[model samples]
Target: MFRKASRLRLDGSPRRVVLACCCALFVAASVVSAQQPPAQRITTNFKDADITQIAEAVSMATGRTFIIDPRVRAQVTMLSSTPMTPDAFYEAFLSILQVHGFIAVPSGDVIKIVPDANARTMPGTDLPDRPPSAADEIVTQVIAIKNVSAAQLVPVLRPLIPQYGHLAAHPASNVLIISDRAANVNRIARIIRRIDQAGDSDVEVVTLQNASAVEVVRIINSLYQQQQAAEGGGANPLRLAADERSNSVLVSGDPEQRLRIKTLIAHLDTPLESGGDTQVRYLRYADAEKVAALLKEQVTGIAQAAAPGGGQQAAPPQQQIDRNTTIIADPETNALVITAPPKVMKSLMSIVDKLDIRRMQVLIEAIIVEVQADKTAELGVNWAAWSEDDDTRFPAGGFISPVGGSSLVNLAQLAADPEAAAEAGIGIPNGTTLGIGRIAGTGVNFAAMLRALRGDANTNVLATPSAVTMDNQEAELKVAQEVPFITGQFTNTGAGGTLNPFQTIQREEVGTILKVTPQGGSWRT
Candidate 1:
């Protein structure tokens, strides 16, 4: 019974120890719960509130610390219809700050808010002051200026640039480098485009062939100076230069000014004419001279014929004739240069047509002659029996045997053999042996005939005859001859050769014995 009681006591003691340990754990958990802050629920709606106000509201709602940088000046609005947890509240607050160009940074339990533009930090500091936004933001752009010098253009464009904008000109390259705000840079580019387009339209180069370069330059300068003087020194932007390489005048100015100058140049380049019309009539070489002479004679005759009535009428004082027509004969070009009134020129041309109607007939005569050399001389010599060193049988050194012939020997047989001919002096030229071996009749060997008639004096070969050999020997020749002749006149004339004696006698008697003739009279009774 005592042993069972001791065992029950031990069990009771373990239950008490278990109860004590549970009580200690409950106390420790209660202490930890008391030390931790409770999760806060936030609910807020702020409309277009300043960043400072938004930050203060967020801090009050979340029961968290927030340090707002003095430079965080951006405004923001926050709206939340439903209740927000602590995390949601922080997220919404930070998003508001960020939307208003502020950056929210957490440090331990506190959040630091700084302007986004001023978010830069020094090595040891958390935030630095932000520079002005407008002055700090810079953009660069390059613009091309055409036909206008950048030095001249920069001054005009500099005034258009904003105060904070900067412009630089690269004159050698004709480009402008501009640095300014995005809006200001765009404005400058527009101005540059307009200026460049205007300059392109104003600039022009005109090629001049017959006009004098110096004279053109002088005229352009004079016009520009006059414009300057008239406008009281506010002259058109004009640059005039004469390009000697291309022989052109480059005029760069306002379009109106260039037009005026071009008009003046046109007027200067036009040839001045007198009150009469000048006409050029082309005539034959001889006809040009004849027309000129005929015009002079006809004009003189008309002037003389319009004088007093008759010789017996005691012709009044000879009235001077107005020979207003001038005719010049240009032999070089075979043209008649006429300057007169329109009607007078027309009348003169009509007369010239009548006087220049003579026809020039050309007679062509031709004769073909075939000259043949007496090749029968070659028949007398037996070339097979002829040999060198046989002076009695064949002439010495005349007919050389093939074995004894030198390499420079030009034998007749070499003409047939090209290799042998090349071994001899020089190879025969093409067509040199055209009429060899083939013989028909005594007609000429054209090649030999040509050689024979080379230096003839009277028979001038104006053009080489179209000579062709029919059967290697018979050659036909075709030649052309020109005979120039003019119509209406022949130098030689003759009387009739056939005559009757009775008629001749009767004619002489009738001439001598006339009935009632003016000089003499004869009576036949």
Candidate 2:
């Protein structure tokens, strides 16, 4: 058996060894090609080649497997301007297939060259994750709408797609379904995203008080159309509608566009004679003249402050008014006739609202008391009774006690019997503090007199005065009199420095006069 084995070993076949070596080399080359396949440059000029022949050529060049559907058969004519790599060749091959009304759909390891119509219903490969390499490569994409209506976009995007392509919107999902070439699908998706973006889209109704709404809207639309003509076109279209019955302008568009339209409306929505820049707003609580005066002064001050060196030479009479708009008051109607742009009017009205409110009032009551410190106190309305014959004097005037209230009350009462009161030398203004002088025989009277009761009741009550005023207002109450006092006296020399009576007298208030200022506000204040 050993000798037979040795003989067989020596008789081994060379063909078998050669076959093994060949297999080894082939496996090594396959592994190297799989790791890094060398790029192949495709240079083809097919004058009139069958579709199958073209497919075969593409397969050989790209080293990719391909299967042609029986329905796909056409003679194609194409030429390569220059050599192209494998990727570039694939792109060109797709274009060629598309031109011939065919498409190549990738199916598991093999690419299927099928009729374009059949490719849609073929299933699986019809849906691609992203756009393909070629512009004409058919694809389907679903784009959801966020801001705009999806069904509306179908009509817009349908024109962009080829006749063989499809565009539809699923109303329930607000999503668009588009099927076209890869490039067209991507383009449509981008358009959908841009159009569906969130914007300042709202409807504003502005009431017109003095201007005609229809005319205003017409003018605004004309201006918008002119602007569009200037810009060639605008992506965002503004819609201005007018309700004549309500006399209001309806504006609908993106926020920025709507703002521009509103500004125009604010300018146009004014009385015809008012020039769209003037307004006569009637005031309710504030004095129109006062408000106008203050605002004009403020505007003038600001203009002056803004000028170089505060102010230079004399300015035009209306220069100050023109520089910062105009504010004039109407006295007859108690209205504000404003000559300014809508922007200035808006700010002015804001201030007017705050200033034209009715302020709360304050009721202030003051009690004035004149207390005599002496134990023997008199309700002291002093009176005088001097005998004309004798120079002696006696007190004679109206009196008041603890039991009786004020006597010889006010000037109104004194005027009632002025003739009789003047006979008693009581002819003085209400401000004077009466002096009680008495003649030796004449009777005397007093305003009030009271002695101490118990030991501490030595005070007398004089007057109680009150006044009502608005918030932050001042009030004065005077139940008082003015009495004359000698300020200075001069004596002339009468025949050797004898006394000569010359006096300077000053009259000052001698009784109660109360002044009060009260401020009112909210809790924190």
Candidate 3:
């Protein structure tokens, strides 16, 4: 029984060994099969076939699924004389499709076949009919550029992108974002890479400390014009933009051009002394019109006098006005904004000081008179009327022209005939006349003309000067007069001197004082 059992066990061991070996061999074969490439050979000929059918045959041979867009309805004819590998077949097929305005795009294991014009329009099976999200089919790339503002590069890069592509640049961030098909995105990347490899130009920002924004802009524009004229037809290499808010200039170009501009700006914007190259003078009490006129006239006169002919054969108008100087008068602020070189600004300030100095003060005395109704006709004469023989019309020795609508006449005639003067609207009831005189140097002669007119009993002067004080460019005058007592009769206790009891005198005083200053060669009170 033992011998029989031994034989059975030995047979079982052999069978088990054979089974283990067979399993090992099967696993090895499976691994080899998995590691091997799939068969991609094909042989085909078609007299005339729809492009869809051709795509289908190629897909079947290569074991790759191909989807034909419903919009593709074109038919094609082809002949493949010999069998070809999957790679070669794909290349040949794509070439043939390209000839017929079609393309094949791969999506993972699947291929999309469509007309070239409809490639972007065709919708994917799983994708909705909306535009492709940038996260999906389109690739987004952010590139950093050095020494160039994004705004400056956008124009140069825009035309390089495909029509369906999108490009945007953030100037502050100095980053460029591009969204497009993978191929186009790659192309743009290569382009940017090439540009970066070519080396970047320098971008500089220069702030103007002593230069006006207007002057800087003018200089830049003039330089650009000259550059354009020299270049004739080509684009200007240098680009300049002025920022008035920051009072700065931005420059971009090649190294040499940028250096040239920088040097030019530096030379033009050299700093002046501690006081600066510009000066703003405020005309406190002067009219801006008169000041500006005086400045122009005086500056022109000085320039002409300095010329060869002693104010004759003047220089051209353009040459007379210095280009480096700028004067802006702001009437709202009553200020003269002057910008120029140091010497020129100094000269302008001196001129302003001279023109704004205060000179002499003149005291004007005007007497207002009211005549009685019965005596008004005797004073019927126009005080402002002047004839060829009337040389002494004004006490100060100037012809007194009628102001407003009042007619000028002889005062002597008015004194002779007061009744006629009232008939001519000279001193009638509410009518008034002015006896005006001026004291040139010193001593206020208040009512001097009125005292002279007092010889006629009909004349009545209403106001008189009480005191006059003359300062450098100003004067103060006070006039005191007697007021007629209406019905009250009282003794004057404050009257220290002798009183005129016959005239029934009561005191009434009226005076006006003003400070006068000379502005732009004219007196302002």
Worst 10 residues of 3 by lDDT: 1-10
Backbone clashes counted, model 3: 23
- Give stretches of model 2 more than 4 Å off: 1-37, 124-129, 197-200, 206-525
lDDT (10s digit) by residue, model 3, range 1-525: 001111112125876557445544533433343234666344555533455545655554455677666666654556666756665655666666766766665566676766665544443323223333222234456777654445556678899865545688765556677755444566766777666543345678988776655467677877686644433312224667888656688887677777888888888787653333566789865656678777666566655564565446655433444444667788888889876655455567777777665444455555556676543221322222222233333233223443333333344346658888768667412345555533233433322122111122366786654333233444444454455555554544346675544324555653444344323344464
* Worst-scoring 10-residue span by lDDT in model 2: 1-10
Off by over 4 Å in 3: 1-49, 58-67, 70-96, 105-112, 121-188, 197-213, 218-252, 255-301, 304-332, 337-525
What is the Cα-based lDDT of residue 402 in candidate 1? 25
Please list the C-alpha lDDT of all candidates, in the order they appear.
0.51, 0.63, 0.55
lDDT by residue for model 1 over 1-525, one digit each (tens)? 001111112125876557445534533433343234655344565543455645554455456676666666643545566756655656666566545566554555655665654433311112223222322223456676765556566778888865545687775566777755444566766776776653434568876644545568876788567655433322236668887556578887778768887777676654323334467888742458767888878667766876776656754322233345677898888789987644455567777666554343222233333444433111111122233333333322222322212212333445457686677555433221222222223432111111011122233234333432212133333343343433333333346655433211111111111112121123121
TM-score rank order: 3, 2, 1
Give the TM-score comparing model 2 with the true structure, all chains together: 0.34
Q: 298, model 3: CA deviation in Å?
A: 7.0
lDDT of residue 408 for candidate 1: 20
On a 0 to 100 scale, what is the lDDT of residue 51 in model 2? 58
lDDT of 2 at 29: 36
lDDT of 2 by residue, 201-313 (tens): 78999998766677788778786786554432333457889886677899987787788888887886654422335667788877899999887776676556545554566
